[model samples]
Structure formats: structure tokens, C-alpha cells
Target: MTRPLRLDALAYGGDYNPDQWPEEVWHEDVRLMREAGVNLVSLPVFSWPQLEVAPGVYDWAWLDRVIEVLWAGGIRIDLATATATPPAWLVRSHPEMLPSDSDGRRLEFGSRQAYCPSSPVWRANVARMARAMADRYGEHPAVVLWHVSNEYGDHVARCWCPESAAHFRRWLEDRYGDLDGLNEAWGVNVWGQRYTAWEQIEPPRRATGPVNPTQLLDFERFSSDALLELFRIEVDVLREVTPDLPVTTNFMSLLRDLDYWRFAEIEDLVTDDAYPDPADPRAHVPAALNYGLMRSLKGGRPWLLLEQAASAVSWRDVNVPKAPGRMRIDSLQAVAHGSDGAMFFQWRQARYGQEKFHSAMLGHRGEQSRTFRETAAFGRELQRLAPVKGTRVRSRVALVVDWDSWWGSSATESLPSQRLGWLAQARAWHAALHALGHAVDTVRATGPFHGYDLVVVPNLYIADAAQAAALEAFVASGGSVVVGPFSGVVDATEKVHPGGAPGPLRGLLGIEVDEPWPVPDGAAELVELDGERFDAPVWSEWIEASGEASVVARYATGVLAGRPAVTRRAHGAGVAWYVSAALAEGGLVAVMRRALADAGLPARTRIDPDVEAVTRADDETDYTFVLNHGAREVAVDVPEGAEDLLGGDATTGRLVLAPLGVAVLATPRAAEPPFVTLSETTD
Candidate 1:
């Protein structure tokens, strides 16, 4: 579990672009902030060009006044260093800092994140700017957090150029120590492509023949590390100047290019920017999954929902307003998952700009409209539930998050098929646990796994012997595991493991796979679990038990009909299960529920499908948040003696929730805290 924000309760409000308006309008903005219970506002996100008008020079006059005004109005400020967008002067002077795409075309500097992450010139300039910002505002009373570069690697995730090639070579040398090791790992001898010198290697850029799998994987890793290095330079400066203020950069959730597991470790707090389209039917599922992963990034600590659309967003082809109360419900959902703060992208809608159509707490009409009223109401609700602050969600389930597997499967050409889902397959497994009402953490498959009773590794395509050993030991020590198909098929170097597939942990699974059969481009098949038939249209493998593994499910039809589709083996004190195909949504849910039962983990709360139930606990109470995302009313059977926080009354049974409605049930705890942690207080 996690804890509170800057003050006694949840922090609110978001990006405030006071520079866009005149100084006379500043007082009115502050007045509106106070009325809406705005507590925190991030400042100067895209202000690099404005901050540095000339080379090696900065103008901080407007930012200083804005911070002072917000502080006088009793609002905390999340100070951004304003390096997300580089100044045109800097880019124009050093054109080498501009990033090139995979096609070798240099992208122009009219947009944000224009500087190449691997460019040394860009890094040095960004460092000076970060230091200047930190020195000027380090001691400000209103600033409680330092916001690093906004959403690293969002637009320019990869840069392919001669400079990038040099950086990639250095990164590889650091990892493998020598050219011989790189040759061996990449298996360059296979295509008469052995490297004799350090300069012989280049990034996987614009190739006619298939690029080396390991080369492609290494390039992805290098790009992620390059972004990390850029962010760390700013983080180091902030720690030196504002040592006590928490530092964080908002992560765009599930960004495939940047490695979040690596980025999360270097920051003081983890925060994410989520803008799920209200019109998509599967929007909330991904949002929920990302929230769980974001919370887990800091060890299930209290993270913040740094940005969300109060109504509609600008970038999408279609911008749809959030149905009434949907914003409130989703905001609270972030809290239920483990957010200590709820914020949006903009406090006020911009009059003219790229994101002018983006919705904000105070739209163009100001605070006299529905958006402002809803924002104010949500603020008041956060104030009422202040007691729930500083609490965390507890869970015994963990889902494996492996970046190497992600790159190995998607960035390379060795995938069984182009349609073989990478991260989607992984998130599908999480969706199953979520559907069953169990809290789950997404953690690294190669890292230390602890305090988790059940670990689910979905599509972990790349696993070394050491990783396999760790999983074996975990299962041997009374921890249940559910392994997905196509896992443990290769090593970290993108080389297929010797012997059959699932090389290292094959014995733990007690089964051997013959070959994987991908569903035809336009076909689907069925598998039978117990007595129920389920469609599986992804990939299936032929499996035969080696020792003690028993078949759990089998393909009902096909040339290899009646073959084992799923298997389970009883290890020393725990059980290891495996799913050998991409099952339908319901099939995945059924398998996961059975796996949870095998691990003795029960649902936190049983409710309707569209209603989400999550519990968070503090020193005294277990706060259950039930939110109905459906369009119709749903009845929830209330537990005895539970008091409804919204109604301020004790409820006995049968509470009906209208569409987009929410209810908080507080139940007293008599035992010790649910899950033990490193600290009792977030302070």
C-alpha cells in the first residue's frame, strides 16, 4: 500500500499555463483555483523556447510571478524544468541534436521532444537549463515537487543516425565488454557478418535484408537507456538543489519505447498521464491495467494520476465528452487502484494552440459551467475522504513485466507471426485477474519476486537460465505460478534456447512442446476446458507430459485434436500451471480463476461485471470503493455494519448504484494491518 500527497489529502489541479494569459487575468485564475479546491498545478511544461530566448540565456520573470501568485492563493506548485521541448535557438545552432527516424530522415524542430536523446550536445544544454530552473526556485515555499521532462520518448522513441550508432556501440561495449562477446551474442558468423573492429557495427537502420534480431533488440534497449540518461541528469540537479522536494516525471503508461521499470527506480515518486477515450468500449480495461502497473512501479506505493481528460481530448480523430459523472468515477478509480492525487492535463482550456480543443477543469466559459461545477464537486469529495489518504492497496498476486521479451518479440523478425500479440497478450492475462476482482502488481520477471503468493508470467518470450531458476525456486517455496505460452523460448540474446522450447524451466513445467501452430490469418479454433468449449484464435502448441504434469485442457478439434492445451504440475509445495494457446477472453478468465483458486486467493468483492470494487486500508479502516461504469443501475450486496462514506450512513444490504455512480464503504479492522510494509507512514 501507499500514502498521502503534499498535504493532508489528495492533491488536485493540473497544468496551469499562466503565460498564455495576461498578468491581470492571473488573479481571476487564482480565485477560480481556490473555489475549485485546486491544491497543485504544474507550471511551464512547454516553455523551453520562451525560457531561453537567446543562447545560454534564460528569462524567468513570468514564471516567478506565476509561482508567487499560486503560492499566495494557497496552491502547491509542481515545478517543471521546461526541457521537454528544446528551444529553437539551441536546435538551430546545433542541428546534430535533431533526431532522425528509422528511415534516416531527420525530423524538424517544430514539435516537442525534437532533440535526439543520445546527442551529447542536447544533454549538456538541458543540464544547464535544469540547473538554472532549480537554482531559481529551489527554496520556493509553494513548490513541493519537481516535474522532470514531460513524458520521455513519447513522440520520438527511436533515433537512427551515425551519432546514434556511435552511442549504441558504446552502450554495447559497456554491456558485453568486447567485440567478440557481441559477435557471439548476435551470432554474426551465421550470415558472414562478423565484426573485426568496434566501428563495424551500426544501428538497425534502413535495411533491405532482415536486420539481426539481437541488433534490433539492442537498439531498442539503447534508445530506452538514452532517454533514461537524459532524465537522470535533470534528476541529479534537482536532488542537489531541492533535496527535500519529491521529484518525478509523468510516464505515458505502457509506452513500448521507454523502459518504465528502469525509469521508475530513479525517481522519488512514480506518476502517470492517462487519457483513455470515453467512447472506446475497452478503454477502462486498459486504463485499469495501466493504473495497477503504475502503482506497482513504485512497489505498489501511492502514485498520482498526473493527467486525464476531464471530458474530451484533442489529438484523437473523434473527441467525445465523458458521460456525466464518468470523470468522477474514473478519477476515484485511480484512487481505488493506489493514487494519492488526481489531476488533469490543463486547468483551463487554451484559447489557441495545438491542444486548444482539449478539455479542462475551467473550459473557455470559465467556472460558471458544468465542467467547473463537476471539478469543484470532485474536489469537495476528495476533501471529505481525507481519512482514506496515506493508505495503500494490498495484494498477493503479481504479473511479470519483461521488457526484453517485449523487444525480442516485437522489434525482431523471429516472431512466429506478425499478429502474435506482444504487450496485448501480457495485458490480457492481467485483464483476467482484474475481472475476478483481485489486485495484481506488474513486476519484472528477471527481478527479485517477493511477498507475492501467485505470479503470472504471460508471453515472457525471452528468459535465461538464471531467470528460469528463480521461477523454479519461487514455485518450490509454496508460491503458485501460471506460465503463458511462448515463454522461456529464448535467452536474453534473442537466441533460441538449446534443446526443446522452454529450455531452462521445461522440467518445472513437466512438459515438452513439439511445435507452435499459429491460427490462420483469418481463422479461429476451439479448445475444451473441463467440459466447456472456448475459442482460441491466436497460437497453440503441441505438448506432451514428461513426468508428473497432468493435462488441464485440450484442443477439441484440428489435425492435433484432443492434444493437451493446458497443463498443471505439482512441485514440492506449490503448483505450476501453463497455458499453451491464446485463449478467448472468457477462456483466459476461466483459466485464471481456476489458477487463483488453486493458490487459495479469493475475490476481494463479488459484484456485477461493470461495477469495480477495490479496497484500501489505513490505520483503522478498510475503504471499499464501488463504482458502476455501466449505463444502468447495479445492485451491490453490502456487508453487515459497513458504513457508506458518501451517504454517511450504515448500510445493511442491497445498495443500488445508478449509471456512473460511486459509493465508498468503510469497514472497521480489528486485526493488524493487512499487508506489512517498509514504513507505516508515507511522510
Candidate 2:
């Protein structure tokens, strides 16, 4: 089993920016935090301009005092690198650092994610600042973790400038190697995109007619890599001084700017920022799935809920306040999926900024507000459930989520129709897994695959040889895997992989694809499974069985109607299942449930349907967190008589839970291993 972090229990409290207020207010903030049982404070997130007033000049008087005060108050610190927003001086002096949109227009200062990732000057300045900060605070007793550049992503296309364009050319050369290879890979012959010379290529610009989708896709990948390298620059600098401290950048949920699966391997820990709509019915399910993705990215490692709204967020067009008990319910949902800590965006509401109206532990009118009382109560409950706080949750199911394939599938210029995007299919499968209560992890083709009992690859269009070999090895070792529609069509270079449709995976899945029907938006086909017909939409791949595999489900109507829509083949001690049609949520769940059962990886907890339950275990005990997301009260059957960690009530059979009610049950303590122990310390 993988080792756990040194956290004692669930770390509570959140973003505390005393710099935004007067020094006299610090004591009152401390009092509120203490009352709320706040143990962790993420500090100095947006204080770069104040810290470094000019080039090569430093001022730590305010920061040092703040850290010392918080430490004295018994609160640990998660120190930020303070590189999110560059100072006005830097932007004024180096205008090249500013990002440009796809239309080739440079953005002005004012917004927070405005820096160009490919700028060497920006990277150098950030790296220098990071090293200096780490050197000053790495030895502090209260410092437990390093928060590298917060939420790095591109809100607009950048690097259309001469320097960035030059760098893009170099990146292309490194990736495609030579002009001939680049031409063939991008299929330049079809649309006059072929380059006779390296310098002739430029980053995709809006003026470029109907911008070739495949080329644009590669450009996006390049940009993500550039930003990831920027993150690495700061991480490297911090590691030089604080070698043992864990480093992480807060990831935005489903933002689509960067492929999180690739970045997960580089960061020491994966922490995500989630702000789901309180009224959206599918909100909690997607939140749970995203948390699972973070955990799986780190190989079943515990992650943190870096920034959530204590009440309501300030970014949306209509900021709806979370209903009664919804905040606590959402926090517990994070823990249920494997979060080691819960934190909010701000400790106190901002006074003069875009986020002035955002909810916090302490409102603008001091600690007299109801939000403060609710936050304190939640913190107290977290402290009470200390035993199961730091436990690690594991999963046997893996789902492949690849950025290259997602880009490739979306960029397809032709096919029968246009509605078969990769994200849609991935979300459909994700929803299916969530409905089934399977703790699913999102894995990339490059990640480790040895221990998982089942693996699902949905719309894996861009398949590489190495990844195909890994899947083969995994199946050979008795692990079952699923490969779905539009999979294995293209190689790493975005070109068709030549042998047949299903390309590299054809031999392993034991199927040869004859053609793929890209059904228009809202068009669907019915597939029969277990004598029940279900709707499968977006696209259908017509296939002919090769070796041992046979059809499991088939299309209901078409010229090639009644053909296979889903198939399975035995390989070694396991099986490889293929879905030729994009199955709906209900059908996908039914299909995956059967797959999990065959792999002996079905959900262990009793099904309540509406009452979502997830269990986490450590060396000492197992904790089951039950959440009632339904409107009416539901009776939850207890695994064994146990005490409710939130309320000291000992709950037995027929426990009635109100809407959005959360319950944490601690199972009887397991025999402690010789080297295992529990502590109350948190960072």
C-alpha cells in the first residue's frame, strides 16, 4: 500500500489575507479562526505587488509579522509563491510578458491570468521571486507546504508576437523533427498547410482561414506544455531550498485549458478548486468524479480541496447563496472521495475588489454573521471526526482521459456527423461511474497501470504504440479493460495509424473497424444488453469480429442495422470490452456495472440509490460518509452500530437523514499495525 501524508486529521480553515485589512483586525480574525477550529491558513496568494515593489528589491516586514502572528495563534501556514499576478511595474517595463489573443491583440494589465507562458523574462522573474521566498520561510516551523503559482491557465490565445512565434517554431521542430514529417503528420497536402521551410510555420492565428483543427489542436498542446514548464520553473526553485515540502498548483475543475492528467505526474500533490452550482442536479456527482480524478492522478494519494466557497462564489453571473446545510454537505462530499483537507477561497470577504461580494468565514460586518457561526460549527465537527480525517481511499477502477485524443477527436474535419466530441463521451462515462458509486480514477496513457482491476478508455482516438503495449501488458496480467468508440484512429502525430480503423488497438481488442457513422446532434441508435434496449448516440462504429471476440450489443436501425455496437474478447486471464456506439448514461452504467462485477470490483457498500455512500480506510479504521442528496428523508441502513462523528449521537438501524444531510460513521477500530499511529497535528 502507498504511504500516507503526515497530516493528523482533516485540515480546516482557508485563505486568510490579513494584508487586505488593518493590523488591528488581525486579532479579531485570529479569534474567529480559533473559535472555528481553523488550523490551516493559505496566505499571501495575491500579495506580489506589495512584497516586491521594484526589481531586485524585497520587503518581508508585513509577511514575517503575519506568519509569526498566525503561528503564535496555533495555525499552520500553506505559504504561496505570490506569483499569480505580476506587479504593475513588471508589466509596464516588459510589455512582452503580456499575453495576446488569437486575433493577435495584446491584453492590458488588470486581469489576473494575463502573462504569456512562453515569455522567458516572466519565467525568470517568477523563478527569482520564488527562490527568495522559499529561502526566507523554508525553515519556519509553521510552514508545511508550498503553493506554486495559483491556477495557471490561458484565458486567451497568447504568443502571437514575434518572439513567441519563433519559440513555437522551435517547439514544432522538436516535436515533428523535420519538415517532411511535419507535413505528413498535419496532412498539409489537403489544404495547402504544407511547409517548405521551418520558418514558414506560425502559431495558428484567427486570420488563417477556418484555422485547421488538427494544427490548432497541436498549438493548444504546446501552450499547455509551456505553462506547465513555467510551473516547473518555480517548483524547481522552491525545491532547492525546501527539499521536503510538498509542491502543488491549484487546478481549475474541467476548465479545458490544460490536460490535468499530464500535470498530475509532475506535482507532488494534486489539489483542485471546485465551485459547482448549488442548484444543478448533477453538481455533486461531477464534483465527486473530479475529486476521484485528482486522487487517481496521484496513484490513490490523498488530495486537498484547495479553494471552495464557504457560502457562495463571486465569479458567476448569478451568484446564488448555498442553501442551509449545503456548505457542510459539499465539504463532506470532498472527504468522501479522498480529500485530506477542506479550505475556502477567502477567510474574510474582500473589501475593494472583484470578489468583494464573495462569501467567507467572516463576512464584511465582522464575526456576528450567521456564516461565521456555521463555519465555526463545521470546523468543530471536523475536529471531532479527527480519527478518519487523514485516511487514504483506494480504487480498483481506472478511466483513461487523454488531452491529445480529446483534441484530436474534436478537431476531426470529416466523418458522417459532428456531435461526437471527446469531452462529451468522457463526461457520459464519468456520470455513469458516479451513479454507480465506483471510486473512479482518471489515468493518462503514460501513468502506472499495474494494480487497477478494471480500466475504461472512452473515445481514445489518438492511440500511441507504447500506450497500446501498456494496455496489452495490463490485460496479460489479468486486469480487464474497456476501449470504446472512435478509439485508436490516429497516431501520436495526429495522422491515421495506417493498418485499419481502431488502428493500434485493433489487434488487442480483437476487432477491425469497417467504418464509423457520425450521427448528427440528437440522433441516436438503440443497443440491446441483457434483453433491455437502451439509447446510444453521437456516433456508431461498424466493426467485424477478428479472433475470439463476439458482439455483445448491436445497433437497432440503419443500413448496417443490427450490427455490433459493443463487443468483448478474452485476453489472458482478463477481457477487453469495446463499445462501438456512444452509450447513454443509463446504458453506460449498466455496462460498467457488469464489467466491475466480472472483475470482482463492485461497490462494497449497500445501495440506497439516492443516499450516496463512500468509504475511506486507514490502518486504524474505515470511515463511511453517507450523503442524502434527495429532497425527502431517507432511512440509511448502518453497516454496524456506530457514532455519528458530526453529532455525538450513536446511530443504529433506520437512521432518517434530512435533505443534504451528512453523516460520518467510524467503524470499529481495526488492529493497528506495529508501525502505525495517529496524531492530532495538521499543516
**Clashes (N, CA, C under 3 Å) per candidate:** 3, 0
Candidate 2 ranges beyond 4 A from true positions: 1-7, 154-158, 411-417, 603-610, 647-655, 668-683
Inter-residue clash pairs, candidate 1: 1-392, 2-392, 3-390
TM-score of each: 0.96, 0.92
State the RMSD for candidate 2: 5.0
lDDT of candidate model 2 versus the reference: 0.78
Which portions of model 1 show Cα errors greater than 4 Å?
Answer: 1-5, 603-608, 670-683
Model 1 Cα lDDT, one tens digit per residue, 576-653: 999998987879888987888888876433423566777788767888787778897766665666787877878665
lDDT by residue (1-683, candidate 2, tens digit) is 12233456688988888989999888878878899988888889888988998887778998999998898998888899999888999999999889887678888899786688888888898999898899899889888888887887735434676667777888888998998878887888887777999889888876534666667778878878888788889988887788878888898876566878777767787788888887675688777667877777777777889889977788778888888788888888888788887889889998988889999888777677767878888898777767765577656677887888877666545545567777777777877766666666778775578668888888788888888888888887888888888888878766677966688887779998898876667677788888888887677777888759978877777655788888888888888999888888768877887777768765423333456766677866767677887666766556546777876677654456788887887776544211111112221
lDDT of each: 0.83, 0.78
